[model samples]
Target: MIGRPISRIKRVVLSALSVLLLLLSYTWISHRQHQINPQDTTIPSWGQLAEGAKKFTQPDRKGHRWLIEDSIATGKRLAAGISLGIIFGFLIGMFMGCIASVEAFLQPPISLLAKVPQTAALAVYFVFFGTGMKMYVAMIAFGVIPALAVTVYLAIKDIPSEMLDKAYTLGASHFETAYEVVFKQVLPKFIDAVRLCIGPAIVFLIAAEMVVGDVGFGYRIRLQFKLTNMNVVYPYLVFLAGFGYLLDYGLRFLQSKICPWYQNDSK
Candidate 1:
C-alpha cells in the first residue's frame, strides 16, 4: 500500500519502464523460440492481434462488419446478470441467515446442491429460461448464492450474545433486534460479501458467454479458435483480462468509498 502512491511524473516513468522491460523480455524469448524452429505458425509475440481489431473497420454480414452488436449484447447480459443477480442473491441470502427453522431445513438441501458444480445447475436453468438472459442470471446467481449464504450464516451465528441480550433488555423483539442490532454489526462484512464475489462473477460470466454467447470476448475466442486465427486470439485474451481487471478495480474503489469502516478495521 505504501509503495502504490506516486506523483504523476513517477507513475508515468514507472509505467514506461515496465512496458519497455516487458517488450524486451518478450522479444528475447520469442526470438530464441523461433531460432530453435525453422517453421513456426505462431504469429509475432507482441501486438500481433491488435491488427485484427483494426480489421473491425471492414465488414460484417450487415453494413457494420464487426461483431459490435454481439459485444454490446454480451456486455449487457454481463452487467445485468451481475448487478441483478447479486441483489437477489443478497436478499435470498438474508432470508437464509435470518430464519432459524428455514436455515435448518435448507441446510440439507443446500449441502446436497452445494457439492455440485454450478455449471451443472445450467440444465435446470436452461429448462426455465432457455438460453436467454434469465438463464444467464440464474446460472450466475446459483453459482454465487451459496457462498453468500455461508458467509451470512456465519456472520449471523457469530453475533455476540451480549448484543442480543442488551437488545432484549431494552424491550426489542427478536425481529427488531435482528434488524436494528444484529444487522448493523454485520453490515460491513455484507458489503465485503458483495465485493468478494465480483471476481467469481466475472469468471462465471466468461464461461457462461463462452458456452452460450452469440457475441462477446468469449465468442470472439471461439470464433478465432475455429478459424485457426491465433492472431485474433491474442486480442480476445487481452480484452477479457482488461475487462476483468477494470471490474475488480472498480469494485475495490466502490468498497473503499462505501465501506470506510471495513477498510479501517482491516488496516
Candidate 2:
C-alpha cells in the first residue's frame, strides 16, 4: 500500500496542489511582512517580482541584459565543467573497475580527492587556475568527478563474473570485454550517476562565482543581496531552480530513450 502507484490524473492533481500550496504560503508571508514595513525588501510582492524581472530582461545603457549575459557565461562554464568531469570520471572509473593495477594506483588519490571539500579549497583553485573560467570549471569538475568515478567503479564491479568469463571464452580481448561487455551493462547507471552530479556541479559553480566572478547567476545573486535587492534575488533563485529542474528532466528523458528496458525512478 505504501508504494502503490496512483493514476496519471491523480498524480497531476497532487503535483499542482503541492505547488499551489507553496505559492499561497509564500504570498501570505510576503503580505504579513509588507504590512509590518512597507519598505521591506525581504519578502517581495508580486509587483516587486515583476519589476525585478523587467530589470534583468531590459537592456542597460550598454544594450546588454544582465540575465542573458549571466546565463551565457554560467551556461558555458557549467557545460564545460560537466562534460570534462563525465569524460575523465568515466575513463578513470572504467579503468579502476576493470584493472587491478590501475585501481591500486589510483584509488587512494581519488578517495582523498573525494574527501576534500571542493568549495572550501577556493584559495587553492584560485592559486592554481586563477580567478577565471578555468577556476570555475576546475572547481565544479573536481566537486563531482570523484563521486562519479566511484559510482562507475562500483557499477563495474557489480557485473557478474560469469558474464566476463563467457566473453573471454568467446575470444573477446580485454578491450572488447571492457567496452562491449562491461560498458553496455553500466551505461544506464553511469547516466544516473551523471544525473545525480548535476546539483553538486551547480553548487560548486555558483559558489565560485559568488566568491570571485564578474558575471553569472551567482555573481548577480551576490551583488543584489549586498544591495538588499530581495526582489531580484528571489526571481534569480527561482530561475535557477527551474534551470536545474530542466537539466534533470532532460537527463531523465535521455536515459529513458537510450535504456528503455532499465527501470528508472521517474518520480
Candidate 3:
C-alpha cells in the first residue's frame, strides 16, 4: 500500500515537472522568435502569460469576469448533457443487454447510427435545436450515448449464464432475475461505463461549444486562436486538462465509495 501511493506520487510529480519544462521551453522559443520578428505573436512569452493570468483572475468588467462566468456556464452545460446521456444510455443499454428481443429490435439501428460521425450530424442538430444551449446538450448526449450503451450492453452480456439459470431455477420471475441477479452483479460495471463515457462527452461538448456557445472554454479557445493570443489559449487548455482530471478523479472516488466490491481485488 505504501509503495502504491509512493509510485502514484512520483508519477504525478513527474507529470507536473514535464508540463512545467514544456511551458518554459515554449516561452523561450516564443521570446527568441519575437526578438527575430516583432510581428510574430504566434507564441506568447511568460510575461504575456502572466498578463493573461492577471486579467483572468481580476474582476475587470471587460476581461476576467467573463472567465469565471463562462466557466460556470460551461460546467453546467457539460454536467447536464453528460447526466442525460448517462441515464438514457443506461436504460437502453440495460434493455439491450438483458433482453434478446430488445437487442434484435434496436441494436442494428443503433449500431448504424453510431457509425455516423457527430460532426456530420451537427447541421441536423442545429436545424432541430437551433444553435442554442439545447443544441450543445443534444450534440453531447448524442455523442456519448452510443458509446455508453455499447459499454453497458457488453458488461451485462458478459455476466455468467449460470447465475441467471440458478435464479430462474429458484422460481425467480424475469424481472426479479434481472434486478436481483444481473443488475446487482453488474452495478459496478455501470460506474465503469460512466467513466468511459466522460472523455467522449467532453469532446462533443467542446465541439459544440466552439460553434454555438456564447461562453465556454472551447469558445474562448476559438476566440483566442483568431486573435493569436497563445497566452490565454494555453492556460485555458491547461484548465481543460485539469478539469478532465478532476472530473475523472471524482468519479473514481464515487466508485470506490459506492462500489466497494471493485476494490476487493486490490486488497
Candidate 4:
C-alpha cells in the first residue's frame, strides 16, 4: 500500500482539501493578528489583498503597469538564462559522457562548480558582468548549468551497454552512436533535469533582482518590504507561485507530448 495508486477523483479531492486547509489556517492567523493590532500590515486580510491586486491592474505614477513591466523584464531574462544553460549543459554533458578524455578533463571542474553556492557568489557575478540584465542572466545560467550538466552526464551513463553494442554492430559511427543512439535515450530525462533546475534558476534571478534590479518581481518585493507594504508583497508572492506552477505545468505537458512512451511517478 505504500506505493499504491489512488483514484483520480480521490487525488483531486485530497489536493483541494489540502489547499483549503492552508487558506483557512492563514485566514485564521491573519484574523487573530488583526484583532491584536487593528493597523497591522504584516498579515493582510482579504480586503488588503484586494487592494494589493488593484496595484497590479492600475498603472503607477510613471504610467506603467507594474505587472506587465515586471513580467516582461523577468520573463526575458529567465528565458535567455535558462535557454543558454540548457543548451550548454546538454552539450558539455553529452561530450563528457561519450568521450573518456573529455570526462576526465571536465568532471573535476564541473563537480567543483556544482558544489559552489551560486547565490553566495552574487558579488563575483556582479564584478564580472556588472549590475544589469547580463548579471541576472549569468547568475541564473551558472546556478543551474552545473546541475543540469551532471544530470545529463548521469543519465547518459545509465544507458545499457548492450544498446550501444547493438548500434555499433549495426555499423553506426561513433558520432551516430552518440547522438542517434544516446541522445534519444536521454532526451526525456534531460527535460526532467531541466524541470528540476527551474527553481534554482528562478532563485538566482530573483536574488540578483533584489540586490540591483530596477524592475522585476524581486525588485518590487524588496521595495514593498522596505515600506512594510505586506499587502503588495503577499499578492506578489501568490502571483509568483502561480507563474511557477504554470511553467511547471507547461513542461509536464511538453514532456507528455514528446515522450509519451516515457512514464514516471511525477504526478
Candidate 5:
C-alpha cells in the first residue's frame, strides 16, 4: 500500500513538473516576443487567455455561452457517436473474427474503409445527413467503426486455436466457444482499441463540428479562429486537450476495473 502511494505521488509530481516546464517555456517565449516585437498581437499572454475563458463562460452579447451550452452540445454528440461506433463496431468485429466466411467477405471492404480518410467523407455525410447533429455523429461513427472492427477482428483471430479446441473438446457448442473463449479473451483488447480510437474519434468530431455544427467546442474554436482571437483559441485548444486526456484516463480506469488481470504497459 505504501509503495503504491509513493509511486502515485511520484507520478503526480512528475506530471505537475512537466506542466510547469511547459508554462515556463511559454512564458519565456512570450517575454522574448515582447523584447523583439512588442506590437505582435498574436502571442497572447496567459492572463489574456484566462480572461477569454472567463468571457466564454459568461453569456455573450447574444446571451449564448460556450461552457454551459455548447460544451454539453459537443459532449452529447461525442457520446452518441462514440457509443454507436463502439457498440456496432464490436459486434461487426466479433462476427468477422468468429466467422471465417464473414471475414473473407467483409475484410476487403473494412480494410478499404479504414484506409479511406474519414475527413474526406465529410461532404458525402453532409449530403446525406445535412448540417445537423446527425451529421456530426455520423462522421465520428464512420471514422471510428471500421478501425475498431479491424482491431476486434484481429484480437479475436489472434486467440490461440488450442483454446477453441479445448472448449470444443469440453462439449461447448460453436457459439459458446466463440462467445466464451474468443469474446472473453478479446474484451480487454477491445478496450485497448477503444482507447486508440478516442483520439481519432475526437478529430473527426471536431472536423465535422467545425464544418457543419451550429454549436460545439469545435465550433467555438473555429469561430474564434475566424475572429482572430488567439486568446480564446489558445485556451479552447488547451481545454480540448484536457478533455481528451480525461477521456483517455477514464477509459484506462474502466479497463483496469473490467480487466484486472491484464497488465498495462503504459502503467
Candidate 6:
C-alpha cells in the first residue's frame, strides 16, 4: 500500500520535473537565438509573432471568419484521412501479426516503401488525384498508415503463445481465439499506437493540405506566406497547435476509457 502511493508520487514528480526541464531548455534556446543568429535575416522573434497572432485573430471581430465553405472542406478532408488511416492500419497490422505468409510477402516492400518521404510520395498522388480533399486525404493516409500499421503489428506480435493455447484448449477456433485472446490483449497497445500517431497525422494532414489544398488552414498559411503575412501565419500556427493538442487529448481520453488495463502506463 505504501509502495503504491510512493510510486504514484514519484511518477507525478518526474513528469513535473520533465516539463520544467523542457521549459528551461526552450527558454535557453530562445535567449541564445539573438546572439547566435545575429546574421539570420528572415526569422521573426517569438514576441513579434505573438503580436502578429493578435492582429490576425482580430479580423474575426468583424463577425465573418474566413469562409464556412472552407471550414466544411477542411472537415471533410480530415475525416477522409482518418477513416482511411484507421482501416489500412487495422488491415495491415492484423495481417502482419497473424499471418506469417502475408507478413513475409509484404514486409520488405512495405519497409522499402516507408523509406520515401510522404511529401515526396504526395507529389505523384496529387498529380493522379488532381488535388482537392481527395488528394489531401490520400496523402494524409499514406503518411499515417505505415507507421500505425507497424505499431499494431508489433502489438499483435507481442502476444504470448500460452495465451493462445489457453484459449484453444477451451475449444476456440483460431479466429475466435484471436478475437477473444489476441484482440483483447492488444487493445491497450492499439490505443497507444493511435495516441502516438494522432499528433503526427494532424501535422502531416496540414502539410498535405498545404501542398495541394485550396481552402484549408494549410492553404491559408501558404497563401499568406507568399505575401509575407506573418500576422496571418502566426494565428494559423496557434490554431494548429491547439487543434493538435486537443486531438492528442482526445486519444488519451479514449485510451483511458477503452484500455483500462493501461491507465497507469507512463508512456
* Top candidate by lDDT: 2
Q: lDDT (CA) for every model shown?
A: 0.70, 0.92, 0.82, 0.89, 0.85, 0.73
Task: Give the TM-score ranking, best first.
Answer: 4, 2, 5, 3, 1, 6
Candidate 1 has what TM-score? 0.78
Candidate 5 or 2, higher lDDT: 2
**C-alpha lDDT of residue 37 in model 1:** 71
Off by over 4 Å in 6: 1-64, 67-72, 264-267
Residue-wise C-alpha lDDT for candidate 6, range 55-76, written one tens digit per residue: 5444466664553534566667
RMSD, every candidate, angstroms = 4.1, 1.7, 3.2, 1.5, 3.4, 4.8
Model 5 C-alpha lDDT per residue in residues 1-267, reported as the tens digit of each score: 554545778999999999999999999887787678775547777776777888798888989887777779989999999999999899999999988899999999989998889889889998999988788888888788998899899998788889899999999999898778887788888888888888898898888888877788788889888887878888878888898889989988988887776655434
The clash numbers for all candidates, in the given order, read 2, 0, 0, 0, 0, 0
lDDT of 6: 0.73
Candidate 6, residue 194: Cα displacement in angstroms equals 1.9
Name the regions of candidate 4 deviating beyond 4 angstroms: 264-267
Q: What tens digits encode model 1's per-residue C-alpha lDDT throughout 1-267?
A: 865667999989999999899779867876776688734336544455466666553676667645475567667777777777667556655677778787888777666655777665656776888977787777777667776666777787788889889999999998899788767656667666766776677667667677877776667667777876766676666666677677777777877786676688886
> Where in model 3 is the C-alpha error above 4 Å?
1-40, 62-64
| Candidate 3 residue-wise lDDT, 170-239, digit = tens | 9999999988877766677777777777777778778778887778888878887888887788888778
Measured against the true structure, the TM-scores of the candidates, in listed sequence, are 0.78, 0.96, 0.87, 0.97, 0.91, 0.76
Give the per-residue lDDT digits (tens) of candidate 4, residues 163-229: 9999999999998998887988788899888888888888888888999999999999999999888
2 versus 3: better lDDT goes to: 2
User: In model 5, which runs have C-alpha deviations exceeding 4 angstroms?
Assistant: 1-10, 264-267
Worst 10 residues of 4 by lDDT: 258-267
Question: Candidate 6, 13: how far from true, in Å?
Answer: 9.8
Candidate 5 TM-score versus the reference? 0.91
